[model samples]
Target: MYRIELDRDVCISSGKCVAESPETFRFDSDEIVELVPGAPRLPDEEIFDLARDCPSGAIRVFEGDEEIDVH
Candidate 1:
């Protein structure tokens, strides 16, 4: 299983994440990325790809206690 997190302060508002995974992520009024409520879980590889694709490195993926290094 995997977990995901986003750092709003670190987001660049590039919209890459939202564009790639509209079902899982969206932009708020301020344009910062926010997770969609009750969104379906993505596959493990997709989760890692999404995190790695964040230009601002704002997306974080984890497996239990250890954070996956997507950089």
Candidate 2:
């Protein structure tokens, strides 16, 4: 299984992730990207694409302890 995480400190509030996968991500009170609780999950490839599309490179996908390089 793959795990996705948002680096809030690195996030630029681009909303690209939310726009691409609103079911998996959302904006917090401060407009930083956050994972939605109990939201529907996206496939690993879709998640990777989302990360690749992130301008700030804030989205990170990991398999176990290894971080996948989206670029």
Task: Please give the range of 10 consecutive residues that has the lowest summed lDDT in model 1.
Answer: 62-71
lDDT of 1 by residue, 1-71 (tens): 89999989999999999999999999999989999999999998889999999999999998898988977
What is the per-residue lDDT of model 2 for residues 1-71, given as tens digits with 9 covering 90 to 100?
A: 88898899999998888888888899999999999999877888898899899999999999999999989
Strongest candidate by lDDT: 1
* Stretches > 4 Å off in candidate 1: none
lDDT of 1 at 68: 83
